[model samples]
Target chain A: GAGVSQSPRYKVAKRGQDVALRCDPISGHVSLFWYQQALGQGPEFLTYFQNEAQLDKSGLPSDRFFAERPEGSVSTLKIQRTQQEDSAVYLCASSISGALGGELFFGEGSRLTVL
Target chain B: AQSVAQPEDQVNVAEGNPLTVKCTYSVSGNPYLFWYVQYPNRGLQFLLKYITGDNLVKGSYGFEAEFNKSQTSFHLKKPSALVSDSALYFCAVRGLQTGANNLFFGTGTRLTVIP
Candidate 1:
Protein backbone atom coordinates (compact mmCIF):
# COMPACT_ATOMS: atom_id res chain seq x y z
CA GLY A 1 0.00 0.00 0.00
CA ALA A 2 1.11 3.55 -0.62
CA GLY A 3 0.09 4.49 2.88
CA VAL A 4 -0.95 2.80 6.09
CA SER A 5 -4.47 1.40 5.97
CA GLN A 6 -6.67 0.59 8.93
CA SER A 7 -9.91 -1.35 9.09
CA PRO A 8 -13.17 -0.81 10.96
CA ARG A 9 -12.71 2.95 10.93
CA TYR A 10 -15.31 3.11 13.68
CA LYS A 11 -16.40 0.50 16.18
CA VAL A 12 -19.13 0.62 18.80
CA ALA A 13 -18.84 -2.01 21.47
CA LYS A 14 -20.90 -2.64 24.57
CA ARG A 15 -19.30 -2.92 27.95
CA GLY A 16 -17.38 -6.17 28.40
CA GLN A 17 -17.42 -6.83 24.68
CA ASP A 18 -14.30 -7.53 22.69
CA VAL A 19 -13.11 -5.56 19.67
CA ALA A 20 -10.28 -6.02 17.24
CA LEU A 21 -8.78 -3.41 14.95
CA ARG A 22 -6.53 -4.08 12.01
CA CYS A 23 -3.69 -2.19 10.32
CA ASP A 24 -1.79 -2.71 7.07
CA PRO A 25 1.33 -0.67 6.97
CA ILE A 26 3.07 0.74 3.97
CA SER A 27 5.05 -1.59 1.75
CA GLY A 28 8.44 -2.64 3.10
CA HIS A 29 8.02 -0.80 6.35
CA VAL A 30 10.29 -2.32 8.98
CA SER A 31 8.78 -0.81 12.10
CA LEU A 32 5.18 -0.71 13.22
CA PHE A 33 3.57 0.94 16.22
CA TRP A 34 0.20 1.17 17.94
CA TYR A 35 -1.16 4.12 19.88
CA GLN A 36 -4.31 5.21 21.65
CA GLN A 37 -5.64 8.73 21.50
CA ALA A 38 -8.33 9.88 23.87
CA LEU A 39 -10.61 12.83 23.31
CA GLY A 40 -8.62 16.08 23.21
CA GLN A 41 -5.35 14.24 23.85
CA GLY A 42 -2.28 13.24 21.90
CA PRO A 43 -1.54 9.70 20.78
CA GLU A 44 -0.25 7.47 23.53
CA PHE A 45 2.13 4.63 22.74
CA LEU A 46 0.72 1.15 23.10
CA THR A 47 3.13 -1.22 21.41
CA TYR A 48 5.94 -1.42 18.86
CA PHE A 49 7.25 -4.09 16.53
CA GLN A 50 10.47 -4.47 14.60
CA ASN A 51 9.55 -6.71 11.73
CA GLU A 52 7.63 -9.69 13.21
CA ALA A 53 9.35 -9.34 16.54
CA GLN A 54 7.52 -7.55 19.30
CA LEU A 55 10.24 -5.44 20.84
CA ASP A 56 8.07 -3.16 22.97
CA LYS A 57 4.79 -3.82 24.71
CA SER A 58 5.56 -1.82 27.81
CA GLY A 59 3.12 0.91 26.85
CA LEU A 60 0.06 -1.31 26.80
CA PRO A 61 -2.19 0.20 29.42
CA SER A 62 -3.66 -3.02 30.81
CA ASP A 63 -3.91 -6.75 30.35
CA ARG A 64 -6.99 -6.22 28.21
CA PHE A 65 -5.01 -4.44 25.54
CA PHE A 66 -3.12 -6.70 23.15
CA ALA A 67 -1.37 -6.17 19.82
CA GLU A 68 0.44 -8.41 17.38
CA ARG A 69 2.25 -8.07 14.11
CA PRO A 70 2.62 -11.66 13.11
CA GLU A 71 4.01 -11.38 9.56
CA GLY A 72 5.63 -7.96 9.84
CA SER A 73 3.17 -6.50 7.39
CA VAL A 74 -0.28 -6.57 8.95
CA SER A 75 -1.06 -5.97 12.59
CA THR A 76 -4.02 -6.27 14.90
CA LEU A 77 -4.98 -4.65 18.18
CA LYS A 78 -7.44 -6.50 20.39
CA ILE A 79 -9.24 -5.19 23.41
CA GLN A 80 -10.99 -7.64 25.68
CA ARG A 81 -13.81 -6.82 28.06
CA THR A 82 -13.88 -3.29 26.85
CA GLN A 83 -14.80 -0.56 29.28
CA GLN A 84 -16.34 2.87 28.85
CA GLU A 85 -12.99 4.39 29.60
CA ASP A 86 -11.58 2.58 26.58
CA SER A 87 -13.52 4.72 24.20
CA ALA A 88 -10.95 6.46 22.05
CA VAL A 89 -9.17 6.38 18.71
CA TYR A 90 -6.69 3.62 18.10
CA LEU A 91 -3.94 4.59 15.69
CA CYS A 92 -1.35 2.52 13.86
CA ALA A 93 1.88 3.87 12.38
CA SER A 94 4.84 2.54 10.44
CA SER A 95 8.31 3.64 9.52
CA ILE A 96 10.68 2.55 6.83
CA SER A 97 13.55 2.18 9.25
CA GLY A 98 13.69 -0.08 12.25
CA ALA A 99 14.93 2.64 14.56
CA LEU A 100 12.42 4.55 16.67
CA GLY A 101 13.88 7.92 15.75
CA GLY A 102 12.74 7.68 12.13
CA GLU A 103 9.70 9.47 10.78
CA LEU A 104 6.43 7.56 11.16
CA PHE A 105 3.57 7.39 8.72
CA PHE A 106 0.13 6.89 10.21
CA GLY A 107 -3.14 5.36 9.21
CA GLU A 108 -6.60 6.87 9.32
CA GLY A 109 -7.11 5.28 12.77
CA SER A 110 -9.92 3.21 14.26
CA ARG A 111 -12.30 5.03 16.54
CA LEU A 112 -13.70 2.73 19.20
CA THR A 113 -16.74 3.83 21.11
CA VAL A 114 -17.35 1.71 24.17
CA LEU A 115 -20.93 2.18 25.26
CA ALA B 1 11.14 8.13 31.45
CA GLN B 2 10.74 10.63 28.70
CA SER B 3 7.77 12.99 28.64
CA VAL B 4 6.59 16.10 26.79
CA ALA B 5 4.38 18.96 27.88
CA GLN B 6 2.21 21.20 25.73
CA PRO B 7 0.98 23.79 28.18
CA GLU B 8 -1.69 25.44 26.11
CA ASP B 9 -4.87 23.57 25.33
CA GLN B 10 -5.45 25.78 22.34
CA VAL B 11 -3.80 28.59 20.37
CA ASN B 12 -5.54 31.14 18.24
CA VAL B 13 -3.73 32.93 15.41
CA ALA B 14 -4.76 35.15 12.61
CA GLU B 15 -4.03 34.09 9.02
CA GLY B 16 -0.77 35.47 7.58
CA ASN B 17 0.48 36.10 11.12
CA PRO B 18 3.18 34.16 12.84
CA LEU B 19 2.13 31.16 14.94
CA THR B 20 3.82 29.18 17.63
CA VAL B 21 2.98 26.08 19.66
CA LYS B 22 5.08 25.61 22.71
CA CYS B 23 6.53 22.28 23.89
CA THR B 24 8.89 21.16 26.62
CA TYR B 25 10.43 17.77 27.32
CA SER B 26 12.21 15.80 30.02
CA VAL B 27 14.36 12.76 29.50
CA SER B 28 17.24 10.90 31.04
CA GLY B 29 19.48 11.12 27.98
CA ASN B 30 19.65 13.36 24.93
CA PRO B 31 16.17 13.80 23.50
CA TYR B 32 14.81 13.30 20.02
CA LEU B 33 11.92 15.68 19.63
CA PHE B 34 9.18 15.66 17.02
CA TRP B 35 6.13 17.66 16.03
CA TYR B 36 3.10 16.21 14.28
CA VAL B 37 -0.19 17.58 13.02
CA GLN B 38 -3.58 15.92 12.96
CA TYR B 39 -6.69 16.73 11.04
CA PRO B 40 -10.23 15.54 11.67
CA ASN B 41 -10.76 11.87 10.82
CA ARG B 42 -7.18 11.65 9.60
CA GLY B 43 -3.92 10.35 10.91
CA LEU B 44 -1.06 12.41 12.29
CA GLN B 45 1.47 13.81 9.85
CA PHE B 46 5.03 14.30 10.92
CA LEU B 47 6.23 17.88 10.74
CA LEU B 48 9.79 17.99 11.98
CA LYS B 49 12.38 16.38 14.20
CA TYR B 50 15.43 17.47 16.14
CA ILE B 51 18.10 14.87 16.57
CA THR B 52 21.67 16.23 16.60
CA GLY B 53 23.68 19.21 15.40
CA ASP B 54 21.39 22.05 14.34
CA ASN B 55 19.03 23.80 16.72
CA LEU B 56 16.50 24.77 14.08
CA VAL B 57 14.97 21.90 12.12
CA LYS B 58 12.69 22.46 9.16
CA GLY B 59 9.97 20.06 8.10
CA SER B 60 6.96 19.62 5.93
CA TYR B 61 4.29 22.23 5.24
CA GLY B 62 6.59 25.17 5.87
CA PHE B 63 6.87 24.21 9.54
CA GLU B 64 9.97 24.57 11.64
CA ALA B 65 10.87 23.79 15.23
CA GLU B 66 13.62 25.20 17.42
CA PHE B 67 15.41 22.82 19.72
CA ASN B 68 16.52 24.51 22.91
CA LYS B 69 18.57 22.22 25.06
CA SER B 70 18.92 24.77 27.82
CA GLN B 71 15.20 25.26 28.28
CA THR B 72 14.40 21.63 27.42
CA SER B 73 12.04 22.96 24.82
CA PHE B 74 11.29 22.29 21.12
CA HIS B 75 8.75 24.79 20.01
CA LEU B 76 7.02 24.56 16.59
CA LYS B 77 6.83 27.79 14.65
CA LYS B 78 5.59 29.09 11.35
CA PRO B 79 6.21 32.46 9.83
CA SER B 80 2.71 32.74 8.41
CA ALA B 81 -0.43 31.04 9.60
CA LEU B 82 -3.10 29.75 7.29
CA VAL B 83 -6.71 28.88 7.92
CA SER B 84 -5.99 25.48 6.42
CA ASP B 85 -3.38 25.00 9.09
CA SER B 86 -6.06 24.77 11.77
CA ALA B 87 -5.53 21.40 13.37
CA LEU B 88 -4.24 19.57 16.41
CA TYR B 89 -0.52 19.62 17.11
CA PHE B 90 1.39 17.15 19.23
CA CYS B 91 4.88 17.10 20.69
CA ALA B 92 6.71 13.87 21.37
CA VAL B 93 10.04 12.92 22.86
CA ARG B 94 12.27 9.86 22.61
CA GLY B 95 15.39 9.47 24.66
CA LEU B 96 18.76 8.08 23.60
CA GLN B 97 18.57 5.19 26.05
CA THR B 98 18.36 1.71 24.56
CA GLY B 99 15.02 0.83 26.12
CA ALA B 100 13.60 4.31 25.80
CA ASN B 101 12.85 4.30 22.11
CA ASN B 102 9.15 4.58 22.65
CA LEU B 103 7.90 8.12 22.15
CA PHE B 104 6.18 9.93 24.96
CA PHE B 105 3.66 12.44 23.68
CA GLY B 106 2.19 15.58 25.15
CA THR B 107 -1.54 16.24 25.51
CA GLY B 108 -1.66 18.11 22.20
CA THR B 109 -2.56 21.69 21.34
CA ARG B 110 -5.42 22.73 19.13
CA LEU B 111 -4.41 25.44 16.63
CA THR B 112 -7.16 27.62 15.25
CA VAL B 113 -6.18 30.04 12.51
CA ILE B 114 -8.70 32.79 12.01
CA PRO B 115 -9.08 34.23 8.57
Candidate 2:
Protein backbone atom coordinates (compact mmCIF):
# COMPACT_ATOMS: atom_id res chain seq x y z
CA GLY A 1 0.00 0.00 0.00
CA ALA A 2 1.14 3.57 -0.67
CA GLY A 3 0.28 4.43 2.91
CA VAL A 4 -1.33 3.00 6.01
CA SER A 5 -4.95 1.96 5.39
CA GLN A 6 -7.83 1.55 7.87
CA SER A 7 -11.30 0.16 7.47
CA PRO A 8 -14.76 1.41 8.46
CA ARG A 9 -13.94 5.08 8.68
CA TYR A 10 -16.86 5.43 11.04
CA LYS A 11 -18.69 3.03 13.34
CA VAL A 12 -21.74 3.60 15.47
CA ALA A 13 -22.31 1.04 18.19
CA LYS A 14 -24.82 0.79 20.96
CA ARG A 15 -23.55 0.49 24.47
CA GLY A 16 -22.47 -3.08 25.29
CA GLN A 17 -21.94 -3.93 21.62
CA ASP A 18 -18.65 -5.27 20.35
CA VAL A 19 -16.62 -3.52 17.67
CA ALA A 20 -13.59 -4.28 15.62
CA LEU A 21 -11.20 -1.95 13.77
CA ARG A 22 -8.61 -2.96 11.23
CA CYS A 23 -5.34 -1.48 10.04
CA ASP A 24 -3.02 -2.38 7.16
CA PRO A 25 0.26 -0.66 7.61
CA ILE A 26 2.72 0.44 4.94
CA SER A 27 4.61 -2.44 3.39
CA GLY A 28 7.61 -3.60 5.44
CA HIS A 29 6.93 -1.44 8.43
CA VAL A 30 8.43 -3.14 11.47
CA SER A 31 6.52 -1.45 14.25
CA LEU A 32 2.76 -1.08 14.59
CA PHE A 33 0.94 0.98 17.21
CA TRP A 34 -2.63 1.80 18.17
CA TYR A 35 -3.85 4.92 19.89
CA GLN A 36 -7.13 6.39 21.09
CA GLN A 37 -8.17 10.01 20.64
CA ALA A 38 -11.06 11.58 22.49
CA LEU A 39 -12.91 14.58 21.13
CA GLY A 40 -10.71 17.67 21.22
CA GLN A 41 -7.81 15.69 22.65
CA GLY A 42 -4.51 14.28 21.52
CA PRO A 43 -4.02 10.62 20.74
CA GLU A 44 -3.21 8.24 23.59
CA PHE A 45 -1.13 5.13 23.22
CA LEU A 46 -3.06 1.86 23.27
CA THR A 47 -0.76 -0.94 22.18
CA TYR A 48 2.42 -1.65 20.28
CA PHE A 49 3.80 -4.54 18.24
CA GLN A 50 7.17 -5.40 16.81
CA ASN A 51 6.76 -7.76 13.90
CA GLU A 52 4.32 -10.49 15.02
CA ALA A 53 5.26 -10.15 18.66
CA GLN A 54 3.07 -8.14 21.00
CA LEU A 55 5.81 -6.27 22.76
CA ASP A 56 3.63 -3.89 24.71
CA LYS A 57 -0.01 -3.80 25.72
CA SER A 58 0.35 -1.66 28.79
CA GLY A 59 -1.58 1.22 27.30
CA LEU A 60 -4.76 -0.71 26.58
CA PRO A 61 -7.44 1.01 28.62
CA SER A 62 -8.91 -2.27 29.82
CA ASP A 63 -9.19 -5.96 29.17
CA ARG A 64 -12.02 -5.13 26.75
CA PHE A 65 -9.48 -3.60 24.41
CA PHE A 66 -7.55 -6.27 22.54
CA ALA A 67 -5.19 -5.84 19.56
CA GLU A 68 -3.48 -8.42 17.43
CA ARG A 69 -1.03 -8.33 14.55
CA PRO A 70 -0.64 -12.01 13.84
CA GLU A 71 1.03 -11.64 10.46
CA GLY A 72 3.07 -8.57 11.29
CA SER A 73 1.44 -6.74 8.36
CA VAL A 74 -2.20 -6.42 9.24
CA SER A 75 -3.57 -5.63 12.68
CA THR A 76 -6.94 -5.57 14.38
CA LEU A 77 -8.27 -3.90 17.52
CA LYS A 78 -11.32 -5.30 19.20
CA ILE A 79 -13.33 -3.64 21.91
CA GLN A 80 -15.93 -5.64 23.72
CA ARG A 81 -19.02 -4.27 25.44
CA THR A 82 -18.35 -0.80 24.23
CA GLN A 83 -19.34 2.00 26.56
CA GLN A 84 -20.31 5.59 25.89
CA GLU A 85 -16.99 6.73 27.22
CA ASP A 86 -15.34 4.71 24.45
CA SER A 87 -16.66 7.09 21.84
CA ALA A 88 -13.59 8.44 20.10
CA VAL A 89 -11.25 7.99 17.18
CA TYR A 90 -8.99 4.95 17.06
CA LEU A 91 -5.70 5.57 15.28
CA CYS A 92 -3.12 3.11 13.94
CA ALA A 93 0.45 3.98 13.09
CA SER A 94 3.46 2.20 11.65
CA SER A 95 7.15 2.86 11.61
CA ILE A 96 9.85 1.46 9.40
CA SER A 97 12.07 0.92 12.40
CA GLY A 98 11.38 0.43 16.06
CA ALA A 99 14.17 2.79 16.98
CA LEU A 100 13.45 5.73 19.25
CA GLY A 101 13.88 8.26 16.47
CA GLY A 102 11.80 6.52 13.83
CA GLU A 103 8.94 8.53 12.37
CA LEU A 104 5.52 6.92 12.62
CA PHE A 105 3.11 6.99 9.70
CA PHE A 106 -0.54 7.06 10.73
CA GLY A 107 -3.82 5.93 9.27
CA GLU A 108 -6.86 8.10 8.57
CA GLY A 109 -8.35 6.65 11.78
CA SER A 110 -11.53 4.74 12.68
CA ARG A 111 -14.09 6.75 14.56
CA LEU A 112 -16.22 4.84 17.03
CA THR A 113 -19.34 6.45 18.38
CA VAL A 114 -20.96 4.59 21.20
CA LEU A 115 -24.46 5.63 22.08
CA ALA B 1 6.59 8.98 33.06
CA GLN B 2 6.86 11.09 29.90
CA SER B 3 4.26 13.59 28.87
CA VAL B 4 3.76 16.62 26.67
CA ALA B 5 1.65 19.73 27.05
CA GLN B 6 0.28 21.88 24.25
CA PRO B 7 -0.72 25.00 26.17
CA GLU B 8 -2.87 26.51 23.44
CA ASP B 9 -6.04 24.82 22.42
CA GLN B 10 -6.35 27.04 19.35
CA VAL B 11 -4.19 29.48 17.44
CA ASN B 12 -5.21 31.88 14.69
CA VAL B 13 -2.71 33.34 12.26
CA ALA B 14 -2.96 35.56 9.23
CA GLU B 15 -1.75 34.11 5.99
CA GLY B 16 1.86 35.01 5.13
CA ASN B 17 2.54 35.83 8.75
CA PRO B 18 4.64 33.70 11.00
CA LEU B 19 3.00 31.04 13.15
CA THR B 20 4.02 29.32 16.35
CA VAL B 21 2.62 26.37 18.33
CA LYS B 22 3.95 25.79 21.80
CA CYS B 23 4.81 22.43 23.42
CA THR B 24 6.43 21.52 26.71
CA TYR B 25 7.55 18.10 27.84
CA SER B 26 8.40 16.27 31.05
CA VAL B 27 10.46 13.12 31.36
CA SER B 28 12.58 11.42 33.97
CA GLY B 29 15.43 11.00 31.52
CA ASN B 30 16.31 12.55 28.17
CA PRO B 31 13.36 12.96 25.83
CA TYR B 32 12.75 12.26 22.17
CA LEU B 33 10.36 14.86 20.82
CA PHE B 34 8.23 14.92 17.68
CA TRP B 35 5.61 17.03 15.98
CA TYR B 36 2.70 15.77 13.90
CA VAL B 37 -0.15 17.45 12.04
CA GLN B 38 -3.62 16.21 11.21
CA TYR B 39 -6.08 17.33 8.58
CA PRO B 40 -9.76 16.53 8.31
CA ASN B 41 -10.40 12.92 7.28
CA ARG B 42 -6.70 12.33 6.93
CA GLY B 43 -3.98 10.67 8.93
CA LEU B 44 -1.39 12.49 10.98
CA GLN B 45 1.75 13.51 9.11
CA PHE B 46 5.09 13.70 10.85
CA LEU B 47 6.65 17.11 10.81
CA LEU B 48 9.94 16.83 12.65
CA LYS B 49 11.83 15.24 15.55
CA TYR B 50 14.56 16.18 18.00
CA ILE B 51 16.85 13.43 19.17
CA THR B 52 20.48 14.09 20.03
CA GLY B 53 21.51 16.63 17.45
CA ASP B 54 21.26 20.41 17.37
CA ASN B 55 18.37 22.35 18.88
CA LEU B 56 16.67 23.25 15.62
CA VAL B 57 15.42 20.48 13.33
CA LYS B 58 13.76 21.00 9.93
CA GLY B 59 11.07 18.69 8.66
CA SER B 60 8.58 18.17 5.85
CA TYR B 61 6.25 20.83 4.44
CA GLY B 62 8.59 23.66 5.40
CA PHE B 63 8.00 23.03 9.08
CA GLU B 64 10.63 23.28 11.77
CA ALA B 65 10.88 22.85 15.54
CA GLU B 66 13.19 24.16 18.20
CA PHE B 67 14.22 21.90 21.07
CA ASN B 68 14.92 23.79 24.27
CA LYS B 69 16.46 21.76 27.05
CA SER B 70 16.38 24.35 29.81
CA GLN B 71 12.78 25.38 29.21
CA THR B 72 11.65 21.81 28.40
CA SER B 73 9.96 23.16 25.28
CA PHE B 74 9.86 22.03 21.67
CA HIS B 75 7.84 24.61 19.81
CA LEU B 76 6.73 24.22 16.19
CA LYS B 77 7.25 27.22 13.95
CA LYS B 78 6.75 28.27 10.35
CA PRO B 79 8.19 31.45 8.92
CA SER B 80 5.07 32.11 6.85
CA ALA B 81 1.63 30.78 7.49
CA LEU B 82 -0.63 29.51 4.72
CA VAL B 83 -4.36 28.92 4.72
CA SER B 84 -3.63 25.37 3.74
CA ASP B 85 -1.72 25.00 6.98
CA SER B 86 -4.88 25.20 9.02
CA ALA B 87 -5.19 21.98 10.91
CA LEU B 88 -4.50 20.22 14.22
CA TYR B 89 -1.02 19.95 15.62
CA PHE B 90 0.25 17.48 18.23
CA CYS B 91 3.39 17.19 20.24
CA ALA B 92 4.68 13.87 21.54
CA VAL B 93 7.45 12.75 23.81
CA ARG B 94 9.18 9.46 24.59
CA GLY B 95 11.73 8.62 27.24
CA LEU B 96 15.19 7.66 26.00
CA GLN B 97 15.50 4.79 28.40
CA THR B 98 15.32 1.16 27.38
CA GLY B 99 11.81 -0.36 27.07
CA ALA B 100 10.28 3.03 26.40
CA ASN B 101 8.32 2.04 23.31
CA ASN B 102 5.22 4.19 23.43
CA LEU B 103 5.03 7.93 22.80
CA PHE B 104 2.93 10.13 25.04
CA PHE B 105 1.08 12.88 23.21
CA GLY B 106 -0.29 16.24 24.26
CA THR B 107 -3.91 17.31 23.99
CA GLY B 108 -3.19 19.03 20.62
CA THR B 109 -3.61 22.54 19.28
CA ARG B 110 -5.89 23.66 16.49
CA LEU B 111 -4.31 26.17 14.12
CA THR B 112 -6.46 28.32 11.88
CA VAL B 113 -4.61 30.15 9.16
CA ILE B 114 -6.72 33.10 8.10
CA PRO B 115 -6.33 34.56 4.66
Best by DockQ: 2
lDDT of 2 by residue, B1-115 (tens): 6778999999999999999999999987888899999998777899999998899999988999999999999999999999999999999988865344688899999999999
Query: Which regions of candidate 1 deviate over 4 angstroms?
Result: B98-101
DockQ for the candidates, in order: 0.66, 0.78
True contacts kept of 1: 0.64
Worst 10 residues of 2 chain B by lDDT: B94-103
RMSD of each: 1.3, 1.2
Query: Which residue pairs clash within candidate 1?
Result: none
Q: How do the residues A1-115 of candidate 1 rate in per-residue lDDT, one tens digit apiece? A: 7899999999999999999999999999998999999988889888999999988898898999988888888999999999999999999999898664787889999999989
